[model samples]
Target: MLNELFTLKGKRALITGSSRGIGRAIAMLYAEAGAHVIIHGSKPSAKLDEALAEARALGASAEAVSADIGDINAVKGLIQAVGDVDILVLNASMQHYQTVPDFDPETFALDVNANLRSCFLLLQGFLPGMQQRRFGRIISIGSVNQWRPGARLAIYASTKAAQFNLVLNCARAYAADGITANSISPGVIDTDRNAEALADPAIVEKLRSLVPARRFGSAMDCAGAALLLASPAGAYINGADIAIDGGMKL
Candidate 1:
């Protein structure tokens, strides 16, 4: 029963920004769990190819696609390429580290387009099939910043907060249709995006001190929550935000 609950056998999943980091971790896990995976990146790269090969090696049917999620045309093409998926992971996002006062308008728009608008567009394109099938899992990769705003993450945090709200709205509206919408908020994960900052001892120590766990999280730390949310075990869970942030929000 436990095995059945966590299994993703026969599910088709499309995971965006899956060439590396947290997205890649989730894609790999999903593939291992028996899902036909679709890996996506902003553009074709060795990392994307590697992720595709790795997923296929896991004995899961997998394919790769590339698109700038911030662009409507590209997103449309991505939607056309992917067709329909039982699981849609909205993990692609743009983060700019600048204070509110210093934020450039263009940068802010790009962040909004990538992080918030893209989620909406993907949902628009895919939710109908989910509603029809009456079995869909929408997992949006959020951030701890949605709860505890960071000093330099004003725009990024705001978009994430708004994105979570969108998830909640979907959860409420789609529960009867067998669709679950949830967000996972990960804190200070040791991904490539944070490599430069984590390389400095002082910065790493300062960040670690804030977490009660007193350590940084790994990309795999977030993947387990994603697996639960995407599988039968989390069927009853909806309109929820699971924080993988080792008490950082506290």
Candidate 2:
């Protein structure tokens, strides 16, 4: 049953912010593992549809839904569009790294809404169905900053911490119904958005020094842990915040 433990042969997963970055990678991987995936994002993007279609071509059912996750009305509309869900992956998040003198109120609020509040909204829509079915997996993508707060990102760090604790609370509240809640805190991942920061020789050196593994994480690193918790292999795992940071906090 080893393969069965990791197989998502007939599952349905809803992944938010899947147009690019880590979200996109996770969506594609989950589909490859045999789950019907619903690609979600803010506003409709042809590219997102393309990703969904590609997954369908790979022998998995997939679709795309566009919704501004931070907007309650929009999120409600999107939820009504897709009725019930078996798996939920809250991977949409916003970040603003600005020093005190330059930080803007609007930007900070946007980060809070996207990173923390949006998670609440999504769960509000899907949790009930999961409870009724007595089977569900909810995984939220958090940040390493929650455990290792960084400079110029206090607000982002706060939201990540919120995700971590919320998972525990949600798990405890829903476990008896056979639903599981978990979070993945990823370290500095090598993505298009982070290339510039990591390209700086000094910053690169610093990052390497900070992580015991002396390397940056790839989308695959976080995706691997996510799949584990969202699959049968993690049936007994709940109320957990898994860290995939290559020992950066030590």
Candidate 3:
């Protein structure tokens, strides 16, 4: 029964920005649990192709899509291409590391478009089908910055906070429809995105000291929570924000 609770057999999942990192980990795990997985990237790349191939190698039906989610037109095309899915993972985001005063309008707009607007657009496009099916799971990959706002992550953190609010709204409005919307806020993780920063021992030590866990998180750490939220195990959980931060928020 526990296995059954976690199983995603017959479910179709579309995970955005799945070429690598936490998104790829979730995609791979979903495929292993019997879901037909759709992995996406902003554009075609070897990483995207490799993720797709690896997912298929797990004996699950898998495919890849590419779109710059920051562009409304591209997001529309992505929606048309994906059609309908049981699970939608909003994992793609754009982060700009600039002080609030020094931030440029163009970069701010791009970040908002990709991080917040794209989530709204995707939810709007996919919710109808989910409502009709009476089953849907929406998981927005947020950041710990939502709580521990970084000095240079003003815009990124603001968008993530807004995104979680959107999740709460959807969860409240769609609970009766058998749809669940949640967010996962990950703390410092050892992914390619942090490779450069973490490469510096001083920076790594400083960040590590901040987390009670005293260690960096892995993509798989986030993936485990994502699986729980995506499968039957989390059927009754809604409007929840799970922090995969290892007590960093505290």
lDDT on C-alpha atoms for all candidate structures: 0.95, 0.86, 0.96
Q: Return the TM-score for each candidate structure.
A: 0.99, 0.94, 0.99
Which candidate number maximizes lDDT?
3
Check candidate 3 and list the clashing pairs: none
With a 3 Å backbone cut-off (N, CA, C), the pairs that clash in candidate 1 are none
lDDT of 1 by residue, 100-152 (tens): 99998899999999999999999999999999999899999999999999889
| TM-score, ranked from best to worst | 3, 1, 2
Q: How well does candidate 3 match the true structure in TM-score terms?
A: 0.99
* 1-250: candidate 3 lDDT, tens digit per residue: 9889999999999999999999999999999999999999999999999999999999999999999999999999999999999999999999988889988899999999999999999999999999999999999999999989998899999999999999999999998999999999999999998899899999899899999999999999999999999998899999999999889998
